[model samples]
Target: MARVAFILLCHKDPDAILNQVTRLTAAGDYVAIHFDASAAPADYRKITSALADNPNAIFVTRRVRCGWGEWSLVEATLRTLQAAFDAFAQATHFYMLSGDCMPIKSAHYAHRFLDAHDKDFIESFDFFDTDWIKTGLREERLIYRHYFNERSQKRRFYAAFALQKRLNITRAVPTGIQVMIGSQWWCLRRSSVAAVLAFTRQRPDVIRFFRTTWIPDETFFQTLVRHLVPGREIESRTLTFLMFSDYGMPVSFYNDHADLLLGQDALFARKISAEAHRLKQVLGALYASDRTDFTISNEGRTLFSFLTARGRSGRRFAPRFWEAEASIGAGRSLLIILCKKWHVAKRLTAAIRQSTDIPAFDYLFHEDDTPLPDMGGIERSLAKRGRHHRAFVRMLYDHAGTDRVVICLDTSSLDLLGDFHADRADVRILEIDCDLGDDYLIGHAIRVGLAGPQTSRDTFARLLPTIRRDMIHERDAIRDARFKNAARLRETATDAENAAALAVFLGVDDTTALALAQTPHLFVD
Candidate 1:
């Protein structure tokens, strides 16, 4: 029975906004929309006319021309919030969302949690005490007077910034109020929101000071909420899952990001691209579900964040900048075989070589016996490759000819799974479980001297390579997820099935693959 008043600040993507407004109003939630005056007039009319019949949707007439790092963004939010508050008096909470934002969690789940814990979900930290501002002016954003639009008018904006810094111009903050800064998105209890509105009318001096402050939208609500709400009642975290690049811009979400977004504990997410049809569809479906027992979003958040950072900002654990391990580029058509039974893998490699015109290489990555075509002596080559994940893959791509080349993954090759995830454009990964028996792994381990012959299957299994033991750990990232949908072929699989898998990868027919299965062993170690 908890009603939320949603304040939506939208500039583009009217279709997405209309979908969001419709979904929210249909679910018995109220929305106050402020179509930015800077946006296309046709889009505004398109969205408003579509939602005119919905009693829960209210369009703010006093729209402001909003821009980044400008006071207008904050003013626009206030106007929409006030309009929603006046219309939906029964609303218990107010949630702020953007044009690119959408709920990832169910309304029932949100209401139940909000009802149980009457906490204000807003991130507020002492601005002067934290290193939160990475790219912009830190403490000067608050202390220095700002008058120009920071985003659209960069030269004049920085000119004013320089003039203030030269003259040592400082603005005095009102007494007894410690300035705070946080994310612009938030979910707050109605009382705290109403208090903010009241503070605006009562303290014109504070408003005037902030109006000249750089990116006041990020600080105004955050600082005011802290001044009004008790520390105990405020949870210093927004209920929206937001991420930013090193450039301080919101990371846009695409269809492939569905898993990461769905696994988030946040009720909502932003910067979801309108062109991301698949992700939008998935969110639309999940938002309607009443289930509260959802997957824990924080469990995988750390690794995903690391991988994201690794992809965007070149990885720290690599040799050079762009040559980040997870971003190794392809120089030729490549197919990588991930397997356990090396002896069996060699047989398949031989089959591919003898049965067709294509060539296959095995033990190409063995630390002692790797065979490179162009690189010098093995020692010098290994030294040149540097024995690093990024280096190994880069060396391989450089020597591997423009024509198709096949190599079996080696245990000696450091973790290239991340690199494989990135360069899978020309890479084809196929996993084969060539079973001898339930004890086959143990027997193979012993035969290969990987473990003691007397050891149990469980012990031998543990001695296998990481990929041989576990298939999908870091593989959870990127297009390499296609490994999940790949056909699982056994050693004794139907010659047709085996042929099909090999053929699909080799770009040949099943007949050629069958011939490969019978060909003489040619890939000698």
Candidate 2:
């Protein structure tokens, strides 16, 4: 087996970090961990003590108080890489990972994959070609110097802005290097790692230049690798899978995402929290299983195809709908109410129209029969309730743009409008806040058949807490049935039974279903 070096940068969740270390050590790989200097000494001690018996595990002493978007992240990574290289001279590849990351494939498979490929596996793209440029990140992040301290951030930002406006300071690309940006996670050959370290050492000026630049972690390694190996073929795929929210924060995985994670080609998945104990255990067991073949099964592939088609359809329709809305000009503030109960929607719409002027608003009810704007073949693909809601919101944003305010009234609109929040600042989300007693609410739901006739008073009483909780938390029970079912299964079923049930439910093989079912229900409110 080819030796691989794992360089992990961890700050919080000592138990999860320890579990990762234990698993890596068992895989017969060298593991070097760099705990954030800001982390508690107890945490460091707990992790180190757990790994004391393992010869392959070593703690990187040269730690830094790593701050987000600061130079400290690069420094910690360099230190960890250097330590791994020093400790494991026979290692063929170096894998940079976070404490929250878990291997999606067996270690043997990862080693074989790396040994078969000569090119570095790092996601890189031209800096100017990225979406960040459209968001003015070029001016706010690259052109100006941002101070690390929170107290001085705003002051330095405005000062830099004023200076740029007054002096027209054109930020130049670093000497002898074209700018490249990518995900921070990467898998590189030992030779590539050595070359990167050497380049950083040889050019202190390059380090200094990126010191004040925002999120240098995303660019530093990418720029260096491209600069050092000018003509080398760089693979634009990172081994790690990270899903981001519309707000740009990584969406942490839960028990429900196990099937998706297992089907992915990525060797590793990140941002796993300790609270996801079931997920941690499932991934840990897979890592220890030593199964080399990580290919997606036929069922997984079919599901992937379906999801991909749905995504493509959504992308196609969203822009076209936006264009049509734009052509019509800003007509009126869109009032969208998504409710299955026609009576409830009618009552709410009437009350709002009576209290406020209806002439200024265009009322749209989101129901099964509601006709979506004709988008050629794309309109046929919006059969799924969730997808329809998401597409509708995307169209509304595209039509209204950022200038006009869109008022949304839906129990499930918050999640449907997730991707729109960052871009659609003009959207005003309003929920019907009711102060009616539980008896009234239960009676109403019963009348609407939302609650079954067989549901007894005692059962309703037990459900009151859930109702109150949902009210406060803004839960969409109908839309979140899968998650709710998973939570209920975790409480009621054995791990093996849960796995079997999930396999049948998700149409996945037993292994994939087991992986997901074994994960802890960390998403429970």
Candidate 3:
């Protein structure tokens, strides 16, 4: 039997299904683990203990924060591969998979299929404009890098000015930079593994450049393979669809997609439905020797659970709907201020640039304090100049057809949004506070790609306490005489009314608002 080493990078997923791991290990294969470094020591111990039971399994070095499009992940994967090669030199292939992934075919079938191909599968997609991925890659290299550099080096006045020219330079990255569409997960031969590391080591500068680039994972493998292996031997097709089920994000397979996953072509389905227990059961049976029970140590399943449950309690932007709405408004004139932290700001601005509507007002800087001096004088001279800065602000309001402003506040711009939102009730303010109860849910949902009824319940459990606590704080703040006077002036005639009004101000419901106004002393924890 030919041996394959499965290299899995996992984090915060003690509940990942180990049955699949068990099946692969039992199939005369080796398993090498690299759990996320941030995972608790206790959890790591549990993971090690569970894998230790399998003869082919052994825990390697600690993990790191493997951000998308970051160099850390490439470094981590390379280290893991070296360890795997050292631990099991005779293994025929080294397959890099995530905690959320699953093998679709039986172990025997998988081995046979690969043996026949004599090829390495990586999902490398072609870039034609208009496609989200293509546009995204372009912006990351050009526009985003400019704005990112500008914001970080605010003191370097000349550097900020230079960013404008750099942003428009088309085909900025090497034309030879061929992008392949494969699952970041790949099944590779020993030779390919050695080649990847050697190329990366040789081109340390390239690695350093990509370290700061966004979604480094997508490009890291593709760039290396394109540079190292001749394109002929490297199969661009990853043997999996790896599509997100709903909301246009990667997710677990639900009942509806089960047949699609089980169909003829693909060797593995990178994700499973977090909401669909049935899908899990089906996958469990495919890998299990007996019984229908599918619970195993796959972290993807657990992360899926955490996310879907969290998403239910929080706000979510359906990608398709977001795109459609933005599309309809695309041809229109609008003003969009990109006031997020450097990274988040770049993402939002890039999305805006991708939109169909060409914005009339595109402000990239974050702080209100640092208003462009050119704009500041115009604002002061607005009455005399008539069609100047005030006109610009008025034009923005007219374009939107509402007095309300939609501001996306990430980690950095929270304070500004908080103060601004409090003053402008007409503004439809959305605070994308990653710390909010529902925010946590959204994070989890995106990572694991699961959603449904049970997921909703989990969200409520996580969110309710947070809501209650926030309200409790609100109640106490309203008791001061000055607070009462201010409430009265704001048309909040009574304490209950004041609380209710405050709740509305805070974007909470009536019940939550009342709880905050009446029981400020109460702490949720």
Q: Pick the candidate with the highest TM-score.
A: 1
**lDDT by residue (tens digit), candidate 1, 305-373:** 434543342323223444554434545556777665566677777777666666676755553455456
**Clashing residue pairs, backbone N/CA/C < 3 A, model 2:** 278-519, 278-520, 279-519, 279-520
Mark the regions of model 1 whose C-alpha exceeds 4 Å error after superposition.
309-525
Cα deviation of 19 in candidate 2 (Å)?
0.7
Query: For residues 294-352, what per-residue lDDT tens digits would candidate 2 score against the true structure?
Result: 54421323332333343222322133343333231233233333332334444433444
- Highest-scoring model, lDDT: 1
- Which should have the higher TM-score, number 1 or number 3? 1
Tens digit of lDDT per residue, candidate 3, span 217-236?
Answer: 66677666766777788887
User: Per-model C-alpha lDDT, please?
Assistant: 0.72, 0.63, 0.52
TM-score of each: 0.61, 0.57, 0.49
Give the CA lDDT, 0 to 100, for residue 195 in model 1: 96
Better of 1 and 3 by lDDT: 1
